[model samples]
Each structure stands twice: as structure tokens, then as C-alpha cells.
Target: MILVAADRVLGRGGALQLQIETVAGDAGVEVDAVRARFPDVLALATAVLRFRQEQWLTGLAAAAVGISEPRDRILALFSYLESCFMDDDWRGCAFINGYGELGRAEPTIAALADEHLASIETHLRALCIEAALPPYVADGLSLLVQGAKVEAAIHGTTQPARSARMTAAMLMSVYEPAREDLFI
Candidate 1:
């Protein structure tokens, strides 16, 4: 275990140390700690943590939003994705790696991801009730959306988004009517 100091701004315009353990021991400590020792350390840490939470929530929301009316669901999905891409640190993006540090540690990104997934599941169930659709159908749609996200991110394309949109369209196409009003 390596002790890395994450500096926090003090009352007198100085800084304090916040020690974090790193996998690469001293080397990692030096690199990660250097950035943390700034005057606005606490603010920097907060920003980083919040960004991580938002990223995790965005992915979860993309699927969970479908539990509402189609318009609202699509709105939620679009809003979250917009936040993600607009983030300053986004580099074509990647998924969170370690879960251990998040919930218990200062950042708590992993916990955010875990909680967001549960929320998504709940949203799907609620949407089903609202749509008067079978509960199992909602469950299936949620699973499909999850799969689409994973595949899209893995392949580094918009295919996942397209697939998810198609799946949602299918769900909304429950009515076999030959009228435009019956289409989603």
C-alpha cells in the first residue's frame, strides 16, 4: 500500500493532506498525488467524483428512462447522454473499472452505478404499469437495452444506441392497428 496525499484547501488559504492507497504503490502515489495537492484540492476531488457519478447514472438512465411514456423516456436518455459528451474529460469514454473505492471511498462512483441500475429496473417496472403492458415485457425491454449499451460501448460505435432505439420502437409497436395513431 502506498500513501498518496490528496491536498485539501485549509482555512488560511493553505492545503491539507488526504491519503489514498494506490495499486502501484509509491509510483502511483506520486503521480496521482501530484494533481491532488493543489490549492483547490477539495473542489477538484468533488468535481471528479460528481463527474464519475454522472457518467454511471447516464448509462443507467438511458435504459431506465424507457419505463415512462416514450417521449419522457427518450428525453431522459437524451439529456443524460448530452451531459456525458459535454463533460470536459470525456475521451470517447470508457466504463468504470474498480468498484471497491467508490461506495466506501471518498469518490463513491461504484455505489452510484449500483444504485442507478436499481433505479433503472424500478423505472422499467413502473413504465410497464403505466403502459398497461405485461410486467415481463418491460423486464425483457430493460434487458435488451442493457445488452445494447454493452455491445455498443464494446464496439465503440453508436450501434448500441441504434439497437436500443429499435428495441424501444418495437415495444411501442404493440398495437397491430394499420393507423399512424397506433404507432410510437
Candidate 2:
């Protein structure tokens, strides 16, 4: 409950704004109750960060559930994110924000941020390998995804995801000449 409240708070503002009192109130529990579970704002923030990151990955997996083709599975994940871009409350990725806000002050946040990025890379790489795509496809797709994420967050538009999706298709086609028709 506390972590969910913290995530809601984080969804509204930066990590620094996540307060124990706010969480307690949102969670419908006493401040002491909230404190009993999370001794400090940093600890609460850390838990929420992990929660959101895991939720993101789980949701991505769920998105690709019915997908059979490896390349389609990868595209399905990006399409899931493209749909997320339609959410009005979306404020970019919380893990990335957590790192930007308090990563230097707290090493754990930095480590968790690194872990989340690495997980994303691993997922992309695994999908690319399954698709028999060039190794560079996964690396390039990761870069494009990260770049698109930043742009979408800053500009409050879905164009970044569309551009990233198009560029990813183009990149894959380069390594998969036989599938050029599918790409087009």
C-alpha cells in the first residue's frame, strides 16, 4: 500500500517530493504505520522504484503473450510502450527519473537504475537473438528506444515512439534483407 502510494506520488512529481506523510495519507494509514514499513523517504522511494520497474517488465511480458514470432514479440513490446504514450498521466519512466533525482545522494537508487536498464537490454537482446537478427539490431534498438523515451517525455508527444518504431523496422530490415517486404 505504501509503495503504491509512493508510486502514485512519484507519478505526480519528482522523487524528492515523495514524502512519508503524503504516502501515509494516500495509503489511508497512519504515518507511524507507513514508517513501520518504511523507515525513511529514501527507503520508500527505493521500494517504489523497484515496484514500478518490475511492473513495467511484467506488463511488457503480458503484452507479448499471444505473440508467436520473435520479431513480432519485440514489436509488440514497443507497441505496448507506444500505447502507454497515449496515457495523459504518463510522466516518462520513474526509474530514469529516480536516477536523475537522487542517484548521486543514494547509491542504491543508482544501482537499481542500472539494473533496470540492464534488464531492458537483456530482454531486447534475447528477443533479437530469437529472431535471428544481427547482434547490432538489439544494441541499436535499445539506443533508439532510450532516445525515444527521453524525447516523448520532454515533448509530451507520441511522435518519438512512432519514429523509434519506424527506425527499428528499418534497422532490422538492413540485417534481414529477405524480410524487406515485411518491413515495408
Q: Estimate each model's TM-score.
A: 0.46, 0.92
Q: What's the lDDT of the predicted structure labeled candidate 2?
A: 0.85
Q: How accurate locally, in lDDT, is each candidate?
A: 0.46, 0.85
Measured with C-alpha atoms, the lDDT of residue 55 in candidate 1 is 47
List ranges where model 1 is wrong by over 4 Å: 1-111, 175-184
Residue by residue across 25-73, what tens digits does model 1's lDDT show? 3334554554454334344444434454464666755555436464346
Candidate 2: list runs displaced more than 4 Å.
177-184
In the range 1-184, model 2's lDDT, one tens digit per residue, is 7788888898888798899999899899999998998999888988998898888888888989988988888777778778777888778878778899999889999999899888888889998988889756788888887887788899998888888888888877676636577877
Q: List the residue pairs that clash in candidate 1.
A: 67-127, 102-108
lDDT of 2 at 158: 86
